[model samples]
Target: MTDYTSMANGGLPRISPYQAGKPIEEVQRELGLSEVIKLASNENPFGMSKKAVAKCAEALNSSHIYPDSNGYYLKQKLFEKFGYDPKTITLGDGSNELINLIFQTFINNKVNVVIPAYSFVVYPMEATVADAQVKTIPLKDWVIDLDAVYDAIDSNTRMVVLANPANPTGTAVNINKLKEFVKKVPHETLVVIDEAYNEYQKEEDFDDTAKWIAECPNLIVSRTFSKAYGLAGLRIGYMVSNEEIASLVNRLRAPFNVNAIALTAAIEALDDTDHLKMVVAENAKERDRYVKYCEDHNLYMIPSQANFVSIDFKRDAFPIYDALLHRGVIVRPLKGYKLDTILRISIGTHVENTKLFKALDEILKSLK
Candidate 1:
């Protein structure tokens, strides 16, 4: 038989597949439970806008036709809502696809990539597949150390990745400091800010970094409807860069990469600011509950701007995770990220959170 593993790219064989959060049905089937609450994936617990859902349902009739190859109307909606130039927008299945496109476009063995530790796993995964040396910088005080990241960049560094309101840790970098850091990076090096959870941030802390693309042509901002817009199931997202870079990525992007239903849902979702406001507001309200629970229990919860909070249990947390599973409550374990003592829990609805707290109380008491 042929040695298929040897035939693969240098880094492809070494990469571990991404582990998504456990689903409700999977837990129900395995545990023989009738009810399950999932607080693992950082999804909008409130769910998608009714208007977007209706639009998607209507769009199903036209699914046989291909999606707009250019994502024209969605780009127009983005331009109207946020003033993102349509010429500079590249739609993808999700921001995940855009991140991969960026790595495929710019990374190679001769170049390197710089990212803070505990970044969205895709950054390093894509860079590795492109055979680039990944320079992982340690976070300072649970936040990205911009100075350290900047210092790590060299002439061969092709890209620098930052995830505002970072995942797993649920910490965000100072926006002004991030801008200054971007300005300091060399023009030849691309700076990618993955704003996957941008909408969950407080208004005072939010900065639309897409506005900086004209000034910093090498800057690329990727965002998703999967979180605040509650369109994760549809898998729609887009990136903003200079027209030249966008055109380059577009050349390589598969036609109709974003499906018809997703395009329609995103357009409607973007216009439904009322629904967006409700989702973000509820996320903020529930996120505070997690903070208080951590404080009352003496577990340190990382201050988060995203829809999730990572609690440091200060001991191996796998047992707690397994216990929660048995109780029909699913949260994420960070062992894959080498964070054995921390569990990242997505802020769910009030009822769901209450169930988690009750289950957790029982589990913690049993330990005593």
Candidate 2:
């Protein structure tokens, strides 16, 4: 037999593929259960706006033709809504793809990428794929240590990944501290802030990094339609950077990276501000409910600004996660994030959230 592994990229063998939360069908199929609820992937349970769906339907007529390679109309819509320069924005299949492009564009074996330990799994995976030596700074408590991340920088550091309202942990650094860190970072190194859950943040005066793009040439802020906009299936996302860096990132992006239907839906999604607000509001209420459950049950929850809450079980959570699966519900296990005792639960609809607590209560009681 051919040695296919030998022919693959050197990083392929070292990489563990990203583990997405299990889909509802997969749970039913494997467990032979009729009812299943998935609160695993941090998707908006409210779904996207009716207008976005209508726009998607309208766009189907043009599906035979290729989507605009440049994503012109969507870019214009983004500009009008947010006032970001079209030249400084670049669209992608998802922020995930744009992340890979950033790594491919600037990373190399000679340089290193700084990341917070137990943060997003993608940063380390991409850094390894780019063959860049990764320098991971462990989180302080559950939040990214901005100062330590600053300390990790050196002449060979080409990029740093910062997730605001960070995943898994769902905490964020103070804006003032983040600004100070930005000043300390060498202007030559790119600071990539992955804000996949930006909309869910309820903090007053949350940093709008898009406005920082011009002054901070090295800043790259990425946002997606997957969460608050309920476009996870569409996989549409984009980044904000100075024109030069955006140009470089664009060079690595494939033509027509976002499809026509996605672009149309994204454009319409922006116009449906009410729907976005409704989703964000619902998330806040549900996240609070999860927090209350944790408090009442003696579990510790990392105060979250994102769509999920990371609860420390204070013991191995694998059995709990496995048990929850059999009960016809799915939540994210954080073993891959090096937090084996924590489970990250995405804020779902009221029914889904209540079901989770019900199952968890029974599981915890049995364990006791």
lDDT of each: 0.91, 0.89
**1-368, model 1: which lDDT tens digit per residue?**
99998899858988989899999999999889998988998888888999989998999999789888999999999999999889999999999999988888888888999989999888889888888899999999899999999999998888999999898788888888988999888999999999999888877678999999878999999999999999888898999999999998998898889999999999999999999999889889999999899999999998999999999999899999999999999999999899999999999999999999999999988987
Position 47, candidate 2: lDDT:
93
- lDDT of model 1 at position 344: 91
* Candidate 2, pairs of clashing residues: none
Candidate 2 displacement at residue 166 in angstroms: 0.8
Per-residue accuracy of model 2 over 219-330 as CA lDDT, tens digit each: 9999999999999999999999999988998988888889999999999999999999898888888888988899899999998999988899999999999999999989
Cα error, candidate 1, residue 365 (Å): 0.8
Which stretches in model 2 have alpha-carbon errors above 4 Å?
A: none
